[model samples]
Target chain A: MASLPPKHRLQSSAADSAATGQHEHHRPRGLMRWVLTTNHKEIGTLYLIFSLTMFLIGGVFALVVRAELFQPGLQLVQPEFFNQMTTMHGLIMVFGAVMPAFVGLANWMVPLQIGAPDMALPRLNNFSFWLLPIAFTLMLSTLFMPGGAPNFGWTFYAPLSTTYAPPSTTFFILSLHIAGISSILGAINIIATILNLRAPGMRMMDMTLFVWTWLITAFLLIAVMPVLAGVVTMMLMDINFGTSFFNAGGGGDPVLFQHLFWFFGHPEVYIMILPAFGIVSVIIPTFARKRLFGYASMVYATASIAILSFLVWAHHMFVVGLPLVAELFFMYSTMLIAVPTGVKVFNWITTLFRGSISFEPAMLFAIAFVVLFTIGGFSGLMLAISPADFQYHDTYFVVAHFHYVLVPGAVFSIMAAVYYWLPKWTGHYPHLRLSQWHFWLSVIGVNLTFFPMHFSGLAGMPRRIPDYSLQFADFNMVSSIGAFMFGLSQLLFVVIVIMCVRGGKTAPAKAWDGAEDLEWTVPSPAPLHTFEHPPQYRPVEH
Target chain B: MVNVVEDRRPQVRRTVIKTLVVLAGMCVFAFALVPLYDVFCQVTGLNGKTASSAQSLVHQEVDDERTVTMQFVTRGAAGLPWRLEVEERQIRVHPGQSAEVHFTFRNLGERSLVARAVPSVTPSPASLHLRKLVCFCFENQRLAAGESFTAPLVFQLTRDLPPEIKAVTLVYTLYPQENDTVTAAMPDDGKHIDAVATRRWADRSSGGET
Candidate 1:
């Protein structure tokens, strides 16, 4: 029996399991249940809760950096603390907040969208979500250590992050290794689920854009997260093992660190946003009451963008003295990426081009995403001109550019996703007036904060500085005020989520009249068990 | 449905193992970039950096079909008082050919000084294949006031030099060993590789002599 082929083993196991019953007949009670749970929805809830917590914690670090940068005189925190703040803010937001939020959404939504009962490997899903808290906790603890946290910034160049690093940098390396392992495991689970678990009639093309995008993003995670693991392992060896992988004095090249980092990093950014693209693609058409303008084109654009991300990493290092040919090559390749990105923007806009259109809280955020993410993209294109990046590299302009793409671009899509699906999860609608207020305030607050950085950066202010000269003082103040306004307003978002969860206007199975995906076909406040017997999947006509 | 779940588990296991293989492959690629980038730089002369440091001279026969122009450029460090002159600005040599070129180092200041010249080759793709039989830049030159010395450079280009490279330039920048200049007046501690010759040069010093 042990040497039997898979078919024979399956037949024997099926006979044994059918003689018994399903294993989740009764779940444990209290906190222990969550600790030991292998259910996808419960793990998704854990991921969301954990992400929300990290988002606020990372936001606090950002606010402290802003507070210190408010007047240019360094009134509040020391330069060292300010450096730690900036570094922690970037690391936490990227690894902790943004990525986990997407994974949480995928866990909750992927199976539902594909008409699968649960994630392919539910135990691995639990393990992946649990790994985040352990990794981040170890990282956050570094701030209390004698030399303080990793202060070379999130891109953490060598020598600075190595020879000049804090004693706790080794711990940072270990934690990232753990997180990288978690990301790979999570990605493997998702790819397995999407490939293996869809209902009988659903073909690859029939899957929702969200599922499709996550599929691509999952592939990206598998490919690049290992590269990240390798680079960090090199950093570990350089730190403790007397290796010189990033040391120039010992025959190693520091430029190699940048090469490996942005290799993983550029794709890591796409990992953050591709799922957001999936989210926005789902929301825009659902509200506009039209079929997505180009479904196949949207999928193709995502793939092309992921592929192009690999080729354009050197654009970030334009000022690092790359050869003329390499610079020109990266510059051209960077510009080529805009074609696919433009396709995505146009697809969303054309979906909104006119039919019956109404602005739900979710749709409003989606619309803002298209307009604002395009602004970030254009600025990115402007930076891609290798000649121009000489002026823009490491300036607040680069800061503003990525923040725009991330906050309004990725974060807004996440918000829209939450707003769109809160009804399904809670069986109640979000408080509309507060949601509108959250929308408007976030729209205004986000723009007010980052938009002025463009001007300040053009005027030659650099980033990661605790203080600046008097001339850049005014712009910093406005940005600080806006950041505060933005920070405080997100509290309203938390409140809306709580309010929706506790009680609100009850929702029907199809929460939005236009919603027609497999998820919406299930009852509101979906039952603990769904698609256990497998639901019939009908391909939606595009 | 039970059969479906049971049947697909093996496939899922297979996909998981394959995905893990891809992950491992990417990890290997990251390390591979190190050698790949080195090879790329060697091929293109990227950044004009020599890919491998020359330790010992290589023995190779010359190819006479192609003649490559070897140019010499010399510059003295900002405060070093040595002037350098090359035998020729550019000399033609065939691939796998060995040739000798001479350089004169003149001490202009009225103090005894020690100097070292660092050499770099351009059209850097040719640097690795240009083996040096003997070169004075490998060691220091000690010159007293009003003293000058002429040195010879012996080298050969490899037989397989790429056809695209028609010319290569070698540049040297000379810098005074400041500590050696200060120690010029001190008693010999016998630490110098050329301690006996350094004493002879110090004996011939004119102004600022010990």
Candidate 2:
């Protein structure tokens, strides 16, 4: 491959694309380009920026919620609006922020890593990216609707969500349907891209952990997003038409809604986090200057986690009066998930074992992800025990568990990925001093915000409540303050990305010395068209 | 380059379409869960919604010495504008014998309201053992403005009810049906038959209790 000469190879590939007249790089200039272009990179940029905007909007909702909960009394918003705040915050953060952020990363990274020219279905990619804003706009518009937004919580358990829902509930369901459609289409596009568009030499097993992880994540998305659409459609029928699917008088069972919801909801959790596993796998090894330990086992572990995710949704409903056998089955399956998860944690640690480690900003975030995500895993295990879950379910401890997993587990990996790939995307190294400051403040602020939740939850504080007894006031105050600090710190991340994108210090093609992937082989600030002809592959020994 | 990708287009199209078809099928399957849930409940008697009116009565020996404390709880759905209170909040019932409790529902809203009550049994396993011989939940009640009516819930605890469950709570939630005037706009099918069948199933499931 080295004998072919880089200049000649590039010339031939460029000639090949130009002769076809398909690589005509002239595009519609200005906003029209974004609105109409089918380029994967442009669409990925749109997905990412859109998610970041949602994150900020959702963050505002969270801050309003925290401000109200700062003291025992409702000092800011009314209780009803406060309910709306919490509901919108959970919905936006889960669907609009975290999930899309991961998908955005997949869109940018998977094609580059796999040595493909672009996503398999570039047009569908644009469609997926565009649906998000329309869906989210419709969802956010509900806040101004006659009865305000959904106050039944994001889970939207039935009877409450069905018969008592606001008139806007129909719109909310429609918006969810649109968003679900976006996700399903996005998943299909990813699956097609991964299966059919890989470079000739890159076998399934030869791909990086990120590519493998996305393949599985896309499959999970395809499998479950439709189920969510299904459940919401039933909610629509119950609210508008006369259907007792979840009505007891109409011979419909309320618990059946929960069953159907969690069946989708459980795997939904993994859909958000499995990609984090992939991002961490890439970052930790690069920083550690070592090949990822237990590479095959890591793949197997990811697959097992995905398979087990389907079995463990009922762990969320232990307090709903499940029979002993059902409880035990869900309990045992939930605990079994811990095994593959443990394998992943152990693999990351082993990869870091006394290797030539360097503490860059991305590495810092990746390391934090490992330590904090494990704490989350431990709390998850505690909740998995059916007997203990009876005490923990719906409590702030449950709140603490998920936030620890999501904030540090998923969100941190996203930060690390941005930092890790910023140079390649922007052709400039990020401002290092400010980057470090952003990372530390975020870590501290996150702990401050969520750590006290454990104590309050164990002391009998239920979640989704605006007011609490005087005993919880002090902890709530601490949590609220921490939340404000954390929320403000994200502004620094925005500043850093802006400063970097404006050209800080020019970076080379291979941004990091130890980084060894197809992405690094391309020039910094990757061109609009990449890998038009698949790049030749060279096998590396561990 | 165009030919290379174009050559593979049909296969990719097939795969994409197949994936989409699977997604649509899954959505349909989700709707299917409604009927599936009903069938599952009927089979296991899991949700206290076993509406099969074809059961032959099994008269087991009455356990006169055994009594279970049954609590009745009532709640009004939002916008229902109804005040609901159980005439008797708690009752002691003997196994294999029927019991009746009355609930007073007063529609405070200044309009004719059609409301239906839905019931749930707690300690869920107990659902299989508690049989409803006559319950207000069997049909929708249409109440005029300011109308107050006392509806009765007649039920029994079977002798086969596990001895471990000494207490069971039955909660009835009142939801105002979509305004009866709105039904005229919808295509009229014989939905009346479902209500009738539901009542008949309730009757046969607990036939001899009264």
Winning model by TM-score: 2
lDDT of 1 by residue, A388-473 (tens): 99999899999999999999999899899989998877778999999999999999999989999999998999999988999998
The C-alpha stretches of model 2 lying farther than 4 A from their native spots are: A1-17, A20-26, B1-4, B50-56, B60-113, B130-136, B142-159, B167-173, B178-210
Q: Comparing chain B with the reference, what is the TM-score for each candidate? A: 0.61, 0.73
By summed lDDT, the worst window of 10 consecutive residues in model 2 chain B runs over: B181-190
lDDT of 1 by residue, B78-190 (tens): 67788988989899998877888878788898987887766767765577677765566645677888688776676788877778889999887775553453333222233
Per-residue C-alpha lDDT of model 2 across residues A495-532, encoded as one tens digit per residue: 99888887788878899887998999887777666777
- Scoring each candidate complex against the real one, what DockQ results? 0.27, 0.43
